[model samples]
Target: MSSSPLASATFWLLLMNTTWPSHVHNTAPTPRGCASRARGSPNSSCPRQRRSATSPDQFVPRKAASYYDLLGVKSDASADEIKNAFFDKSKKLHPDSNPSNPELHSQFVELNEAYRVLSKEPSRKEYDLKIQHSYQGRQAFGSTSGHTVYRSTTTNDNVHYWEQFRHAQSPEATAEERKQKKKRNFRLVIYCVITMVLSVGAHAVFFRKLEEVHNSFMDEKDRAITELYNEAKERARANGFKKQTEILRQKHADFQEKPEF
Candidate 1:
């Protein structure tokens, strides 16, 4: 059937309306067409969205040393004795002497630092006092901890009961306790000194370690960023960034005309 000219024109107009992008209905401040389209997605961006804080217990690396144990010296050792002990330990633990054990390398450097402090009269005295103070209030955990107040129910006299756990809890009483404490300190110093030495001498020199800590800290921050970006990108892909921006705009916008919910 031959259609009228006006009817044909109306059919073409409807076709054009279906195919073309219409802006007349756009009340958005950003002309919907103007936003830069997501190009080759970078998979990420800097200045990223913020996140909640993590717990302190989870934040730190390894446990810090008990400084007294680090020095591996008797609480009562004389200044000269401390110096000699440090000198002897340092030679044994120095990284040059032991190449196979990386742990030893770290310990070697740590021990050197501890000995360096212990050999000096002022530092040694201060360190000794500090150790004594750390142990003062707390009961010894075991013979190792210098806290030997044990309760035994077996056949034993009161005197025997008193002796079951050597009263080495008091630093002044047991020379053996002092010896153990000193030994522990030596081990600590050895570890610290070796760590320091290895850190310096390591061939690759973990660049991130330059940030006051070992390379691990930088790695942590990077992983955090990666996680954050991945999360955001997923949200962007699923919901579309334009809708997200609109929701945010409506939340913040204070237009006289009520904004569309």
Candidate 2:
């Protein structure tokens, strides 16, 4: 039987996932048993993965992750303390450090990804905002949700910055500060927990919302796909079963004809 367009697209995505080992990102440890199979090409060392922009979610991302979280330090941690933690984790997971182990290798890649974003001042700030946005998304659902996967976050610089702000006389504060005063919000942590619940009902609700928006955006495209599928089946019935191209063209022509609706 002919499949639907959305189903075809989903199938291809899954096939790509299975075919390309590195394309998949495992959240946790997985066995690295396949060597040649994992590489999938004659020249195994060839760079198979290209840097692509990540997909944008429907809602606007919040400014959630603070510098302390980026550096994985306590707000009160000394410079030495922060340095020690970063180096220790970096060394253990660095790709070069664990060449043979895929789990460690992936962790190593993640550590570097995190480090590059966190190390620079401007870049770090941008990343923190993105993190915060993600956090806010999760926290928005927090009251009933469970704990988020949290990393330690307490940095000396952050501690010092807050301390200075606290000391600054209220009368002399900057205009930006006056416009948007700082207050702690812990909603992301709640969202993080909610995600883990694997609540079918919760996901059904969320995806239903996505479906509503999706239907609004591409209702015509959806109808076209369904019509195309129906036509293909009709063609299969009309033409001899042996000829694929003939059936496809017949279906194609049928779809182009205006429907009464």
Candidate 3:
């Protein structure tokens, strides 16, 4: 008694359904431990743990304390006061004195840096300006944002906290100052050139006027001398003619008296 084709196919389907699951179960790989899971795996069902945003292993940069506060001196403290404070602090905080403590050694480095900046006149002024600018910025930001930003008084191991302000006196600022100085010098040169030109022109005009006056005076003097010479010659010629006439008359009278014999 042969079964129909539909019945035979139904029997094979049931057999495969029962046998396939057992074969798959026997051949399946064992589950790995959550600790041994690879990093960045997308299997969210696994009970693997993740680090939080505030994990201690993450690196966060800290702000440094103010130089004046570090040195235990006022912002307006004189050089001698700052020097004396540095010496006093060094006595306690020096790496040699506190060789056992690394924290104190770090503080000593900060102290040296603060003293190096404050001991010099130019560097101290620059640092003061930077501090003042930072203060003003904080005030403005707080007023506008309505948020109080807290500044930390703690020291940072990184020296880049102060190095950031080195950009405040950047080459761009120096170039601008040099440009202003050059502009002033150029204006001074122009003024000097104008003054010299005006003076030379004035001298030329004065000399020309003096030469004209001298020529006119010389012409007048030559005319007066010629007139005087002509008058003297005429008077001398008239006197000579009068004397000749007188001599002729006396000789004629004598001849007339002698001819009567």
The best candidate by TM-score is: 3
Residues 4-99, candidate 2: write the lDDT tens digits.
999999998898777545545554443354443556676455345554566465456433334456457765565455445666776666556767
lDDT of each: 0.60, 0.58, 0.74
Worst 10 residues of 1 by lDDT: 164-173
Better of 1 and 3 by TM-score: 3
How many residue pairs clash in all the candidates, one count each? 29, 17, 0
TM-score of each: 0.27, 0.25, 0.33
TM-score of 3: 0.33
Arranged by TM-score with the best first, the candidates are: 3, 1, 2
Best by lDDT: 3
Candidate 1 per-residue C-alpha lDDT over 1-261 given as tens digits, one digit per residue, 9 for 90 to 100: 899999999999898778534665553354343345453446533223345487566575443454335556666677656555655665677567878876665565455555555655797678667667656644445334443232233343344434423432222334576788999999999999999899777844665457557557888999999999999788878878888788668866656457567
Model 3 lDDT tens row, 1-261: 999999999999898777456677766444567557776689645644568989977965445568898899999999778878887887788667867887775676677778778877899999889877777887887745332233324454445345434422323444686798899999999999999999999999999999999999999999999999988677667768777567678888887889564
* Model 1 accuracy (lDDT, Cα): 0.60
Selected candidate, larger lDDT, 1 vs 3:
3
lDDT of 3 at 162: 54
Candidate 2: how many backbone clashes? 17
